[model samples]
Target chain A: MTRIAEKFVEEFYNSFTSEVLTAADPAEVVDRYYAAEAVQIADGIEIDRDKLIAHLRPVRKNLVSWRYEVHEAVREQEQLAARFTIHAQLRKGRMLSTEVHLFAEFAPDGRLRRATQLTRDVTPQTPQDVTPQTTEAAPQ
Target chain B: MTSRELRVLGMTCAHCVNFVTEELEHLPGATAVTVDLPTGTVTITSDQDLGLPQLQAAIEEAGYDLAD
Candidate 1:
């Protein structure tokens, strides 16, 4: 990626968490990343930016800190496909983390016209050891 | 009434999973939505009253497809 593209990615990640997710005025920050018709998906719910911000407004009030990391990024034409994680720290040492996919498309004027964000809970699974049972009557 | 399994084109990690999950969560009467990254399966449960076409379009807007 070019230096400008790399810088754009870095700045977006920073603003996304601090200015957008954890901003004192979240609605304004959210409007920055999303277009009027942007779609937001969280906790098995989908809504347009207007309704989404309304829902998130309440949630943001309880959140003390929030951060997200983009582990992988691929650029296709004007679209960027990123795989990232969202981690939030609550007031009482409670931490909530989730994974998501972000698709950001830029308009001709260099503004974000559409963004589709998908999120899922992260649950670590334990590896299980499976062994087939042998019948007692089976011949050796 | 119909359930569509969407295979997001740009989704390859947990972040993708979360993004997709968040989108589906907005669907009306969505009982359950699970995004499995390794398998790339977006499983959704609804009351069968929502519009499938609209849902598919929403996924497509994210630059993803509704896989068969």
Candidate 2:
């Protein structure tokens, strides 16, 4: 169960970040992972489906590359919890490293029903190190 | 009793609060454990002064970390 939970967390973020940042229709990517009634709260701000899609627009435009480092993940029944860090490189040499604690509940069909996230910015040890750039072009 | 307040990182839900509270409650002299999920603040009431290592170990065991 632990391994499965960890694998799910890794795959979910990996696919979500990659697809959302590059997909022609990022809303489709959001719908794929989140149920119709899904709700996400990040740092006390509530985000519904429409809000999520709206937030993705800027991310797809400005985000250059990103990756997740999952420190730990666990599951108990339909609830999943994970601790991870996201290293994201943006256009014009901007970088963001954030440590995230996420807790989520899955619907019967495997889509996310609800999620809460707590995040804090962390200084990257090596800001120059970044993942390879995606196919999306950076702003000129 | 000695009350210790700590800021824990990576606790986002009730489950996390319960996990952390349970871990802290298991400490040798812990008499009460209060975990605030939104702020990631944990207040532990114990009979003895718990060292940093001991607190860190308990929080780490619950799959969380102490905020630096």
Candidate 3:
């Protein structure tokens, strides 16, 4: 991704998370993270800039703190794919962590055209939880 | 071990995928979890019996539901 494309992606992702789930305003999302023409796709719903902000407002209420850590970002021509994880807490005292794959596209002018979000849930666990034990105790 | 495909509702973005994959993999018997972005399907592998309640709770906690 070019610097400009990366910048737009950063802003879009940041604002999408912060403004939608953290109750930050659209201006903040726009000023800090999103390109003016960024588009959003969640589930089957698609939204333009204005509608995206509006969609995020209602959803933001259920979240306490939402944050993401990017694992990899790959760009192919005008398309970008970002893979990352998000850790968040809900108002009901529920905590969740998950990974997501984001597909982003850029316009001819280097502005953001669309972003699609796909997710998988993860949990916090000790290393013991994920590691497989091949060593078995000797027959007593 | 058996594997099944599940669709998670209300998921959008990399974070949603991360949250679901992390939570499900922590379950007692889950061996592996795979998510396909375009298809919105979660494929799980486990060596022991898995319960729907546990999966459902985790999904709901993650602010999403298991699609019928």
Interface RMSD of each: 12.2, 14.2, 6.1
Give one clash count per candidate, in the order shown. Answer: 25, 0, 29
Q: Which stretches of candidate 2 lie over 4 Å from their true place?
A: A133-140, B1-68
lDDT of 3 by residue, A1-140 (tens): 45544444444555455544443365454433445777777655565666555434334545556555567777777788887766666544456666777888877655567788866667576211211112221110
Error of 2 at A114 (Å): 0.7
After the best TM-score superposition of candidate 3, give how far the Cα of residue A107 lies from its true spot, in angstroms. Answer: 13
What TM-score against the true fold does each predicted structure earn?
Answer: 0.49, 0.61, 0.47
Candidates ranked, most accurate by DockQ first: 3, 1, 2
Top lDDT model: 2
Off by over 4 Å in 3: A1-21, A24-38, A41-140
Question: For candidate 2, lDDT tens digit of each residue in A1-140?
Answer: 77777777867777777778768898888888889999999878677888777666545555577777788899897899999887767644556677889999998877888999988767466784667533332111
Docking tier of model 1: it is: incorrect
The TM-scores that each candidate's chain B achieves against the reference are 0.71, 0.96, 0.87
True contacts kept of 2: 0.00
Give me the candidate number with maximum TM-score. Answer: 2
Ranking by TM-score: 2, 1, 3
Ranking, lDDT, top scorer first: 2, 3, 1
lDDT per residue as tens, model 2, B17-36: 55577678888999999977
Q: What docking grade applies to model 2? A: incorrect
